[model samples]
Target: MDENQEAWYLWRHVQTQLRVSFGGIVGVDYTALRHVAGILGITLDTAMLHKIQALESVLLKKVK
Candidate 1:
């Protein structure tokens, strides 16, 4: 797959793993993940971050 597609795929996989492992515990601190993504040349933005946060919020609510 192309770079964009690959990045998206990886992001999705990470999101899934995080959801399962953390049980939807989304931390406010995303600097590490964002840095890692940056090093990997993935284009992440505030909006995307918010989406991930939203996913975590939903999951957190479910667990609670």
Candidate 2:
């Protein structure tokens, strides 16, 4: 898959899994997100990164 699609899928997968495992309102941990992104070798823009830091539940439908 393309870079953007892969990023979205991974983000959603982590978000869903975190929520399921935690069994409550769980936000994607910033450190974990960054580590995952690093492993996938994808970079998120400054604005998107800021959003993730401030708004934990933001879903990136498409990266433009």
| lDDT tens per residue, model 2, 20-56 | 2344455566667777777777676785575444444
After superposition, the stretches of candidate 1 with alpha carbons farther than 4 Å from their true spots are 1-28
Q: Model 1, range 1-64, lDDT digits (tens) per residue?
A: 5635544543554554442334545443466557656777766777666666666576667867
List TM-scores for all candidates, in order: 0.46, 0.48
* TM-score computed on alpha carbons, candidate 1: 0.46
Q: Who wins the TM-score comparison?
A: 2
Candidate 1 lowest-lDDT run of ten: 19-28
